[model samples]
Target: MANASNLVIFDIAANNITGPVPNNFGSLRNLKWLNLGFNPLGVNQQPNDLGFINSLVNCTSLCYLNINGNGLTGDLPSSIVNLSITMTELHMYGNHIYGKIPSEIVKLVNMTVLELAYNFLTGSIPDSIGELPNLGKLDLGSNNISGAIPTSISNITQLVALNLESNMLQGSIPTGLLNISTLEVLSLGDNNLGGVITEEIVGNSSQCVFLYLNQNFFSGPLPSNIGRLKHLVQLNVSNNKLTGDIPATLGDCVMLEELYMQGNLFEGEIPLSLKSLKSLALLDLSNNNVSGSIPGFIKGFHLIKFLNLSHNTLEGEVPKDGLFSNMSAFSVLGNSLLCGGIQALDLPRCQVKISRNKRKTFSLRIILLLVLLPLGSLFVCLAFIFYQYRKSKKMNGSVAVLHDQQFPRLSYQDLLLATNEFSPGNLIGEGKYGSVYKGLLESPTRTVAVKVLNVEVRGASKSFLAECETLRNIRHRNLIKIMTACSSTDFKGNDFKALVFEFLINGSLDNWLHPGPYQENERNLTLLQRLDISIDIAMGVDYLHHHSHTSIIHCVIKPSNILLDEEFVARVSDIGLARFSFFNTSNINQAQSSSTGVRGTVGYVPPGNF
Candidate 1:
């Protein structure tokens, strides 16, 4: 006698079963949902008995089958897709399943979430994987997969995350990866992929939050569209062959931190545009061809602790402040141009000495004849000296009026006593500018950053002048407010200069944006706060470019520069160092404002007693 159709729920998942999926599964023709995941169903179970799943070919009513997270082995059943068409979600992670992902699975057009991470799956990613138009997330990380990521993936407009990390994948990234304005998290790191970085980068993305392409063979120039990733946070493209100079356009990522561009061949000067990343921390440009001096233009970013610019061609004296003093480990070795630091392989002291013979070869006869012949010259010289003195007095008077209208006058000792001799005890944190010390005034403790210009550098004199001129008159709520300048006699009655700024209570946005070895609760930022902070920074930037009496660009826009107050409001730190620093500048409001304060160059404070 024939038996009647059997009815079963068929919903036992993660039950730790140690056998192949039973062929008897088809017996439950009425089964709608089946989950056989988290089981030891591999070679340790039934050897090569996955064929049993073929028996379920007749289970036309099955809508959800989650046999994921198992140790399933051997080739997948060819009829897997034929057995289910209504599947909306398929999670097949943490398995040892070999052979190619069945092209048949692409027939599940209704599938929205497909997760196959942490598997031994091989074969090129099927272009058909993009058949699911509603697919929101497609995670294919941690596999032995090979071949180029198909361009067909861009057809899925809803694709949010595309992770292909930890594979033997090669070939240039598909050009379509760049055009998706909605693409958020993109990770193609740790692969054998080669070619230029900008070969396929879509430069005008509005929502790319995190980008990781480390450990590849990418070369050539990075795209200038880098400025368009306004919402970008974590950018890692280390261990590549990228050459040419770093684009100052990178200053556009207002919320970025955790920048890793080490082990490349990037040359040219460090772009002064980086001074705008007021929220940056953990910067690493080690092992590159970056040349010239690391100026104090970056002194505005005040909370960096891990900076590594070693192994590059960077020259001049390393500033003993900020990431320099705090993260001595930040500077490694290999640069032939760098000099004078407490770190390993101390930097060279660059001083030019004239030959003693050249100095002693003066002619006495020429001097005597000149003294007799220059009596007429002496009368003219005296007249000129009087005129020069009068001119000096007039210029001083003009400078005094300019100073009153803009820059505040503070003594060099004011900064010294405020920073406790810039001691480690009073140190609060380091910034892109220099060492930031928590200064205690008479009664109320006022926190401020002291930008000690690295005077010993080869061309640092230009940078000192540049900074003083650039920041003397700039003022904004979101920008770090420079209170005054301090220049006075040193121990030997020489001179030193320092810029004073308001001390931030919370260190940097990096701590809250990406907390390390700590709970989410340790960070006090809320979703509203993050959004508000983002808005505040954007508004501040908008003001600099459009609303200011004189437009300025904050070239660096990483997370370290976004400072949060006790009230959780964000203020953009570091104002205008790029224009006066490396000549790197972007955007303008077309507004023509007068230069009210001193010129940007005359503020240079010589490093030593010249």
Candidate 2:
């Protein structure tokens, strides 16, 4: 107050204070600190009326001024650049300030902390920002700021936390940033910045805890010295063009809790040393080219909560201990070579290997047995068992033919060759049971959809049996026609089962209903097209329920199960959960009493089925 001219400190924060900030606050000439944050103090002000900032100019002694978290509207007054040269902290963020930052603000040579984030500011960040000699923290995130990040920012050697994330900034990161040793958090995510992330970005910032460079065009290998940031707790480089092996030295970051490198071009085995990260809680390496076995040590991560190795070339048995015990917490999808994790992962069982020590003992026992009269009896018994196994195999072959006389038989080799060895490029869709590959079958030479059954899945074998039996005797215009089925071992000597069906060129109904942002050519279905598709689906269901030899219930009739042909004709597919009532009855209200449990996709499962 003017009456108390010697007033040095003014505090009025976190109160429900409303209306305009006083226009005559400059009278408090001796005021060194002014706090009026966390209030609705700028309601219904005239556009561009930041006159309060002008009044503060007379308070030359002001060292701390915080008007943040207010309802302030309009552009920051140009006079903001003329604030007291002695100003040490300027907290004017979380308001409705718009327009360019005035270059004259660099005049606050003594300013230490500049908080101007979460505002409506536009235009390029002024290059003069790097001139503040005492600045330590600079937060300008979650704003509409555009233009390249000024390379001069590196001049502020005292900077501790530099957050330019969630803006329209473009171009590569400035190599000059490496000059700041006090940097603790460098978040440049969700920007259009491109080019390689240089080694200096993190190699020098040993005190950095959080390094987020995701959602950019950063390419090339992660710097070899990335692990130099030993204090890093979270490192996110997802959704970038980064390639090459993940540096094994990452394990040196013992304090790391979250590591995200998904949607990149990384290859080779996951660094074995990563298991040394005792504090690691989350690791996401999805949508990369990572290969080799998932190390068993991953199971030892006691604090791990989320682990995703999906959409990679990883093979071998998945670890099934500790964090891996919870299938919901980790994913190994799209890695067909991977096998055996927790029961819920649905991967193939790992082949058991006898240790060398056990083999040596067995050989010693056999040597002694050979010196006795038991050798002759053992040979005879072995010969008899071999003969019986061959006879059983012959019988099983006949049984398979009898079960589906109409369905043509195919070998795993035949389908594998058709699909170019199940190449990832030919993959059309993925589902609960297994992935679908577009293939070209020989002889007739027609395109087909190959649904390989993952026998590791609990119900996959049952689904194969159900679909095979259902499709054998059924024929309808709107039903997917099963061309053949393959029940044989793969080249790897693993049991391989797949169903071959007529390939629908136009894909599933799911894409038509919800086109992704990346699908530039995708078009929304018209009203007439929607009506026709609905009618076709109804007709197919009608035939399955009433006209079929057995009253069949298509339990999973969701949109994804609906396929559209090139002519826009719809067909119902994925009858893995179909229920067949052998009883000759056309009328059926609820699912048959033989249906013991809930069947079909969660949301589409009929009410009361569960």
Candidate 3:
């Protein structure tokens, strides 16, 4: 290879080549381009595996070099500064190169593209990086690089794409970077950057097509003139501390295809102006304080794919047309005021309201009819007496007994014995409120899951009561059945509360979806089996939200809360955070606020809850 001194272009990428890269590349003085990417060129040969770069310095005519994804290990040699001054592009990402980027790299005066991402490179980016007058793209993402982004980067007038995501970089974004008219893609997500995103940053970036600012600590409202970037194709600002109403002008971005603003503090109704986004495909506004009815315009977007508006204050009827008809395409969960969708949603029916004029006319006729019937007063007294009698029977104790006639009353001792004195071997699952144990009952010769509340937890007792109340009157095949409950003092005289449920041999849906090491054989599920489980879960949630005696919201509806039976039937369990809605459709907002606070497991819970 050293004798090939006249070689001008050495191209061998994306091959199965392995072993150390030859260090004789400097012999090719006329080498103008070299490409060796996507090959295992440097595997375990450590101590300075990238020393071959030192030999490339002799190739004065080299203008382009690409050696990405070669499993190469070692610090980026400082000798790189001696590379050909004519070098315009250098691609060394997806390798094990570490150490600080040499500040003297500015010597490569004509360099344009520099990609060093997906490596272990540390230290802040050199301020001199902007000295390259012709540089266009710079990508240093997915590295351990820390400290503030260099403010000098804005000097690169010709910059088109800048990606610094997945780094340990801190501090607010530099305003000058947004002023470049040629800039199109700006991704700085998954960082510690914070502060208000100024209007100039949004309004000036009129040519930006893809912008990502998600998973950061950026606070304050977005610029009201965000719609100035009419060329935007995708915009993501999710998982931030941003607050205030979503700007109405955002609808002017007619070219937008994907917009994500979930996990933020944005409030008020989803702006009607968004109806103009006919090309939108994916839209997520979940976990916010957004209110009002879901806009009907969403149904007109024929190209729409996924839409999640869960955990919001949205009210009124959910549209049943277009994307709404496909249950898999969208989710409106946690919106207590929402009703009237497809049967699969299980929301209460939307009631028609009487007009003011019609109400007055009806009242006059009712008053006249009452005056003609004195016997109506007698029947009212009889109904009141019957109601009082039932109320008296229900005041037995603090622990409300459910189906007492069918299930036997259980005590603390009964559960202790059933679970073999709460042995570690009997334990099955554990959660924030309590632990669950697998046990056997002698009387019925049945196996069961015993959920024992840890009353020491601040809200354990309340959760216990809530679970009992939710399960007391609701009965559905897809819902877990409570055989009996024990709210008595233990043998040691401490308060003990436990709920007994029929044990499902197949375990939780979480286990089935993401099996542990011990569950190797339980990992695979056919597409049909998965569909059946999904339908079963949807049916269970529908019953809670619509068909039950009272409207119930299973505050936590994650995979862990779903169980599979012997026949693979899904059963929704863990109603410890369930909230009851007794108010009519018109008072849905009041019902939603009646809960003490946002409750549920993190990640699974809506962002608004946090």
Candidate 3, 230-330: lDDT as tens digits: 77899999999999999999998877999999999999999999987868999999999999988888887788899999999999999998899999999
* Selected candidate, larger lDDT, 1 vs 2: 2
- List model 1 lDDT by residue over 511-578, tens digit each: 78787784445776767577768788887777666555445545456676677776777777644333
TM-score to true structure, per model: 0.56, 0.58, 0.59
Q: Cα deviation of 211 in candidate 3 (Å)?
A: 0.4
Candidate 3: which stretches are off by over 4 Å?
359-610
Whole-model lDDT, model 1? 0.69
The TM-score of candidate 1 is: 0.56
RMSDs, each prediction?
17.3, 25.2, 20.5
Highest TM-score, which number? 3
lDDT of 1 at 353: 70
365 Cα displacement, candidate 1 (Å): 32
| Candidate 3: 10-residue stretch with minimal lDDT | 589-598
* Model 3: lDDT of residue 243: 97
